[model samples]
Target: MKKAAFWIAALAVLGGLQLFVRDIVGAYNYQILVLVGINIILAVSLNLINGYTGQFSIGHAGFYAVGAYTCAGVVVYGQEAIRGATGFLPELGQNTVLLLVGLLCAAIAAGLAGLAVGIPSLRLRGDYLAIVTLGFGEIIRVLILNVEAVGGARGFSGIPQLSNFFWVYLGVVVTVVTVHNLVQSSYGRAFISIRDDEIAAEAMGVDTTRFKVLSFVVSSIFAGIAGGLFAHFTMYLHPNTFLFTTSFYLIIMIVVGGLGSIEGAITGAILVTVLLEVFREFGAFRLVNFAILLVLIMIYRPTGLLGSWTLVRAGRRPGRAA
Candidate 1:
């Protein structure tokens, strides 16, 4: 009953904020909130592979681009078809359903891309895996650059703005909860075992390669969903937007937040988003400031801002000393 009440209260608060916050706040602030939510999803999803599962992937942007472009393409071209299929629903309901469907499609597309990349690449470790993923990311960007159907280098435009606070926040919530649950499960232990020592995990019958691919695929799914929301929110898609540099930003978020920590991911995402905005005031000097701050963080607290601190840990009783 207490747990139920807590959930009910949480849902009520979320519903109230989603339904009323935008109306009360300025558009700029509301948009920033939405972006933060999206980043939380991205950072947490990536943490599954890079932190919990212990894989270093620098090609998340490739999956992100895949999701964004696929979603935008559907919105721009498939609306009529979707409308026909959902003709029974009211106009607003139809649009909402289509948007959700588009997001799901984006997730699937990115997961397939992850599978293709992961099957062969997961065999390698460390720098080899990183190099392969990086190359994959570049390949994706190049493909998008030459694909004139999706606007090539000119950029895809005229996408409708279907992303709202509700959807973005809901995505964040779902991603966080799902990842948190996964990390506490037996599969999560296998992932951690692989991360700690792949050979030992394999000898123990953990199926390291399979779990690695599964982690990558799950990470890509949420990354894709984040990309879909970003595409709709910005109403534009550009291949350059998902460049290696974007992936670097994501890495920085997780690193600064602390790998293997969901709370850290959320905190780091929000912190980085705000810092980016704040640094924007410095104009050309923003990157310089950002770099210096990151360097300082590395020097002082190499583990990250949260350093593996988890919200779940806060509620648990301390273990007895040996």
Candidate 2:
């Protein structure tokens, strides 16, 4: 009952923000909130594999790109087809349905990509896995660059702006709750076991490989969802947007927020997203300022601000070793 009340309160707060706070903020600030929610989803999801499962995947951008393109293609091309057949655009109800369907397809598509990559790649650990995932991200970008159907290198545009505060925050809430539940479950122990010691986990009869792949798939699924929301919010898709650096940014989000910490991921995503906007004032030194800020943060908080600490542990004691 307490947990139910917490969820109800949280959703009510988010709903209020969407319905009222948005009216008080500028368009740019409102958009930043949407980005924050999306980033929270990305960081939290990635933390599952990277922090909890002890996997280093640098190819998350690949999954993100796949999802964005998949969703965009569906909405854009489907809209065209409908217009061609009926000489009118889709109604709001139809658009919402298409967007939901597109998000589902995005998740599935990204999960498949995760499986394809995780099958062969999970065997390799550490830097080797990172290199492979990095290459995967690059490959996805290059493939999108050459695909003329999606506007090639120029970029894909004219997508319906279906993403809004409601949807984005809803995704964040669902992701946080779902991932929090997963990490607190028995399977979550398996994941933490793998992160702590794969050999020992295997000796304990935990199917490390299977759990690793599952972690990767679940992480990729949410990343894809974030991508879909972003695609619709921006109403544009650019191959360059999902570059290796974008993946690096996400890595920093999880790292600076705290590895193996859900609250840390959320905090880190919000801080980084806001700092990114602040750094824009530096003009040519934007990246330089951002790098300095990260370096300074790492210098002070090596394990991150939260450092794997959660506000409330679910049915367990706090400070359990990860």
Candidate 3:
């Protein structure tokens, strides 16, 4: 009952906040806020795999692309059918229903892709695993490029702009809460064990492979959901948007925020998003400056801002290190 009340109250607050933003916020700022929320989802989900599970994956953008394309395909092909089936509903209601269905399909598709990739590639560790994942991401992009159905080299467009601040931030909340709970659970401990020492974890009867795969799947699912939101929000899709650099950006978020901290992921997402905007006027120089900033962070604060300190740990033991 308490959990239920908390969710209801939270949703109410988010809804109210959405109204205020819609009424007073400018279009550009509103878009930035939504993008920040989406990045938060991506960063937090990836943290589950790379940060907590001690897996090295650089192909998150593959799962992200899978979700985005799948969602776009579903909505593009199924929109008329959905509208026909719900002819009595208003335009917004119809779009919402379609968006929900697209998100579901996106999640399933991304999960299956993760499972398939994880089962075979997750056995490798360190740089080898990174190579495999990186190849997978590139392969996905190439495949999408050749598929004429999704516009081939031209890109997918005309998607309905159904995503709003409420839905995007709501996704952020769900991803954060789900990941936080998972990390604090027994399974999370197993994940941490695997991260700390895979051999010792296996010796202790923890199925390292299974936990790693599970973490990969969970992370991919949320990444896919974020992709779905991105597709609908932007009403356009381009293969270039989910490139290797995108995956690198996600890694930067988790690393800069702190490897094993949820709050760190959120902070990283916000910081990275804002910095991107702040440096946008610099054009090509932005990349150079960003690289320098990252190098400085690694040299000075390698553990990240929070350094794996979690909110729950802070609450339970205020002064203790995580």
Candidate 4:
């Protein structure tokens, strides 16, 4: 079929590019690619609840951090001194079962945290909801700071670095495909209906509350998984990693990328991630640039760079550029 050929050609192009660019790109560029994957997952997942399902949730970082810390704890406790004895990859591969279990546990912990926050907070709307979610994020951060067992204020050290671009991009591909399918399916139709008009959606027999919770829980699970990958890849994680600043960056990504489009998510993630990394050497003023970029994007092209484009769609187009 055309779709199969499209995917094959796209893969060929990507393979060629990897061969050509592998020697030229720096380690930091690979890091950026990893970040791109993470941000894509984060932004798209948030979109499920906020954009597709029409809910306001600012506490996403809380679940993100929960997955991260939970994963780290398992790896640390399961391996114990092996963390100090060797590195993340060594300890990680030796106990593949434990690692997978750790990741799963991380997702469960985070999804539960999402339910904890969503149960009460999802009741509120508009500004009130934002405040509650924001509060939840702050509570998580402060709690992490006080938990001495996880290294608390000083941060956790010795996390393994087993994540690579393959895992990161694989996550990105999966997140996009998964959310895309969800949106285009029956449940996704309900989600879109809710977004269009909640009162009407419920009047039409859609269980708005149940669907909202479902979307929130699903988003949190994937976001948590991304966080787990992040923690392991970077090998160092702290409460500060999931602070308000992180939430802020993620918001920027969603805002800059069209909220409803997976392509927008990818475009925004790459743009913001690249901007932050490239300008990080600028010190405090780097953030100033970020703010300015946000302002300009909002003012000029608020729909996000790609708007509604999709890689699969692009692949489908006859003679489309690779």
Candidate 5:
């Protein structure tokens, strides 16, 4: 009953958001919303490995870039194989079907890459894993720089800009709900166990290795999905987008939101997104403001704004006396 109500409320909110999109949307304003949606998805996905599972993954951008390029390539060349150009989009564009196919394939390919990355690195924990993932992201950048088919350092373009408020927000919702459900399942418990103490979890027959790999794979898949949405929205893909700065921003979101809490993930993403947007206008002054906020958050609330435990009361009948 509660689940149904939750979905109903969610749908209503989305419907409401759509109605007001025009009132708040302009060329520049819409861009911010789309980016926020992407960031929200990316942050939530990264939280699976970094927060819920306890693995320190820095290769999120690698998966993201892969998805972007995959989508770009399919839109430019895959139309004939998937369907005719006219068959791609009857209402929106000349190749909407190709675009959708590209996004799906991009997500799948990135997920496979995540599996590959996890297989080798999940054995290591903490700093060691972080280093490997960091290196993996760099390697992806270098490889993209050399892939002549992807236009090398010049970057890939000609991608149809199909990403907008609807698609981006859809990704955000899907990622949030999927990760939420995953963390609530048995698998989630195992991931959390590993995060808290891998050795202890293993001793308890939790199969820490399996859980870590699963978490990493899940995180990468959603990261890829976000990448696809971004590429299509911007109509471009470049290696620079998946660099360390991007990873750092994601980590920041997790940190600000509160480690190990999904609510923290959303809160952090929204806060940072809006902050950065408003900061863009302050020129160099904005940097000072942003830095100060980070420092304060770290000093006073290292546990994060919504860290670890949420405020909850013991069971009591609803509408009854306290």
Candidate 6:
């Protein structure tokens, strides 16, 4: 009951903030806020596998693309049928229902893709795993590039703008809270054990393979949801948008925020998003400056700004390890 109340309160706050942003925030800043929320989801989900499970996966973009395309296809093809079936619903209601359906489809499709990849590729570890995942991401992009049904190299367009600040931040809240709770559970202990030492964890009778695959599937589900939100918000999709560099960008977020920390992922997402915007002024030198900043952060902080710290409850001290 207490947990339920906390979530209710959080949702209430998110609703209030959404109204505020819709009413007062400037367009540019609003876009940034939504982007930050999406990045938070991506980073947090990836952290589940990379940080807590000690798995190296650079193919998150593949799952992300799967979700986006799946959601877009559902929304585009099913909207008319849904509208006809529920003509009595108001426009907002209809759109909400459609969005929910799309999100569900996206999650299922991405989860399946994750299972397929995790079962075979997860058997490999370290650099080999990274290489496999990276290749998977590129393979997804190239496959999408050749698929004319989704617009091929041209891009998928005409998508309805169904996502908003409320939905995006709600996703952020869900992702953060769910991951935090998961980390504190028995399954989380198993995941952490694997992260600490896979061989030791296996010796201790933990089914490392099962836990790793489960973590990967859960992580991919959230990434797919984030992709669905992005697709609806942007009202377009392109194969290039899910490039291997996009996966790297998410990696940078988790690293900057500190691995194995939910709060760290959120903090990293916000900081990286804002800093990228600020660096946009540098034009040709943007990547150079950003790279330098990251190097400096690593050289100085090493463990990142938060360094595995998590949000503590009231009456408890802060900076507690996750």
When superposed on Cα atoms, how far off is each prediction in RMSD? 3.3, 2.9, 2.3, 5.7, 4.8, 2.5
Models ranked on lDDT: 3, 6, 2, 1, 5, 4
TM for every model, in the order presented, reads 0.92, 0.91, 0.95, 0.83, 0.89, 0.94
Residue 162, candidate 6: C-alpha displacement in angstroms: 0.5
Where in model 2 is the C-alpha error above 4 Å? 1-16, 80-90, 315-322
Pairs with backbone N, CA or C atoms under 3 Å apart (clashes), candidate 3: none
Off by over 4 Å in 1: 1-15, 313-322
- TM-score order of candidates, best first? 3, 6, 1, 2, 5, 4
Residue pairs in clash, model 6:
none
**Cα lDDT of all candidates, in order?**
0.86, 0.87, 0.89, 0.75, 0.80, 0.88
lDDT of 3 at 144: 94
lDDT of 1: 0.86
Tell me how far the alpha carbon of residue 90 in candidate 5 is from the true structure, in angstroms, after superposition.
Answer: 2.2
Candidate 3 Cα lDDT to native: 0.89
> Which candidate ranks first by lDDT, i.e. highest?
3
Q: Residue 218: error of model 3 in Å?
A: 0.3
How well is each residue in 254-297 modelled by candidate 2, as lDDT tens digits?
99999898999999999999999988899999989988989998
TM-score of 1: 0.92
Off by over 4 Å in 4: 1-24, 80-96, 280-284, 308-322
- Report the lDDT tens digits of candidate 1 across residue range 178-251: 89888778888788788778788889999888999999999999999999999999888888888899888998
> What is the per-residue lDDT of model 6 for residues 190-209, given as tens digits with 9 covering 90 to 100?
89888888888899999988
